[model samples]
Target: MKKILMGVLCLSTLLCGCTKNKDIQIDDKKVGQVKLKFDHIVGAKKLVLNDGTYSNNSNETFNINILKYFVSNIKFTKTNGEVFTIPKEESFFLINASQSESLQPTLNIPEGEYQTLEFNLGVDSLTNTLPVEKRAGVLDVATNGMYWDWNSGYIHFKIEGTSAASPNASKSYKYHIGFFGGYETRTVNNNRVIKIDLTKAGISKVQENLSSDIHLMVDIGKVFDGPNSMSIATTPMVMHSGPHSDIADNYATMFTHDHTHNFQKIANNEK
Candidate 1:
């Protein structure tokens, strides 16, 4: 009778421990949302569409009239080294400096402490070739001006402005960079993947009932001068067919993580 009672007690202790462990286990399947807030800036100054004049490293002052680009293929890395990628269909976003609504791209992802954020600076090649009907929302050609003909694909990045250094009679310059390795014929692929480490700036704590805002600064001046600095006076126009790899390389260095803000999702919804 003593041995039997001892065996029963052990079984009851093990059952209680199992129940306690299950109560404290984290649900990895829980999901949260994050908003990527992009602030357009000219070096140290905030960007003003048509009036603000900024100077690049090449010593050319210019006033921007238009600034737009595509950001897609967003992914987040957790503290445990797990990667959660947003669905491809909902990942494409067109960020236009002129539009306030397009500045922040919200993404729903698994709940965790994310240590890194990754995204493509331009639309991927596969999505670029999708049928016209399949491409909707920001990718819709009829609604957005970023699209070129079916043969040339979409224009990933476009900027237009006026500068005294420009040699044009009107002193205007335009840079439209895009070419996704071509559909049939091979071309220069300017699509670049940008990764931002969140540990130094601020790690994103994405949890249930909370929204994390990852603030990023995009310096427009970097477009003119990064790894390859170019003078506006020498080459004012960079279209689909030209040496634009330098421009692409320069713009790739434009994004920097500024900070992160965690807000109560319920409170935001209430307001």
Candidate 2:
């Protein structure tokens, strides 16, 4: 009877250890929410629709009448190099200068200490190929007027404004960029993968079930004054494949990490 009693106690101890390990595993996999805010500016001034003054590296003066773009495939890389990719269907976002609310986007990700944030400046090729009917979530909304064509693909980025460099009466300019083909064939994949270092902000850990907000700034000047700068006087409108690629490449250099804020919570409880 003494030996049997000892055997039962050992088994109970082993069961408790297993339960504790299982709980720890579940907690490690807990997911958290991260909110991203896109702030637009031209030089040191806030970007406003219809009228925002700014000068680029080319010495060309322009006032933006429309400024909108798409960001997709947002992911975070932990200090150890583990990547937490946001679900593709829910990852695409359109930021419009005219609409203040579209600038803030909330994303759910596995809780971890992220060292870097990565995202695509334009829609991915696969998602771009999907027909409008087959697309779901944010992609299904045609009324947003972001699409270019079903066979070609959606316009990943767009900007319309007036530049002093243009000789036209209205000084109007329009630039739209996207892939030029369907399926595996594409003339130009303007999609850019942008990585931002977050160590400065000390976003070491995103607590489980809590919400963290990351503020990013998009300098409009970089669109025209980037590595391969363009002038409205020479090429005021770029709606097709050629010059659009150069501008898209420039647009890729417009984002920077500003800061971060967090709202801590305990699992399912808010604090």
lDDT of each residue in 1-271, candidate 1, tens digit only: 9999999999999999776221122356886779899999998999999999999878889999999999999999988999988999889999999999899888877777889999998888998888878988899887778878755588889999999999999999999998889888898888988999999988888766668899999998988878887789888999876668888988899999999886545446422
Reference-based lDDT, each prediction: 0.86, 0.77
> In lDDT terms, how accurate is model 1?
0.86
Error of 1 at 129 (Å): 1.3
Q: What lDDT tens digits, residue by residue, belong to model 2 across residues 1-271?
A: 9999999999999999776121112244777778788998888889887766778777888889887788888889887788888888788888887888789877777766778999988778777656668777557646567776554567778888988788788888788877744575547677788889988975635666667788898988777888887888888888764587788778889888898776544344332
Candidate 1: minimum summed lDDT over ten consecutive residues — where?
Answer: 19-28
lDDT of 2 at 185: 57
Best model number under TM-score: 1
